[model samples]
Target: MAKTYKDVKIPEELFFNIKNFIEKYSELGFRSVSEFVNSSARNEMERIEDRKRNE
Candidate 1:
């Protein structure tokens, strides 16, 4: 699938928390909070699909 950007609205507090995580873990591998969020979302979608398939 081709990638296109979409704008998502998250609460300010959650946004700040994610940014803080990115800053703290930058050395661990995450380049930015967006990258972390994207990967996490993709993994969650995969989990949902798998559960639906199993059911």
Candidate 2:
């Protein structure tokens, strides 16, 4: 499936943390910090939707 991504800006500190994590754990299969953040954002979105549905 083709992904339609939306660009969003986050705080520099948070971005730095993500980059730090990417360097600390390179074996997680994430090629870049953006990919790692995108994957984590998708999971958080799903969790939010699930909780909303339950409510």
Alpha-carbon local distance difference test for all models: 0.87, 0.89
Encode model 1's per-residue lDDT on 1-55: one tens digit a residue: 9989988888989988999988877776887767888899999999999999999
TM-score of 1: 0.75
Query: For model 2, what is the alpha-carbon lDDT of residue 27?
Result: 85
lDDT, residue 10, candidate 1: 82
Per-residue lDDT tens digits for candidate 2, residues 1-55, read 9979788898999989989888898888888878998899899999999999999
TM-score of each: 0.75, 0.72
Q: List candidate 2 stretches off by more than 4 Å.
A: 1-6
Error of 2 at 11 (Å): 1.6
Query: 17 in model 2: Cα distance from truth in Å?
Result: 0.8
What's the true lDDT of residue 11 in model 2? 95
| Candidate 2, lDDT over the whole model | 0.89
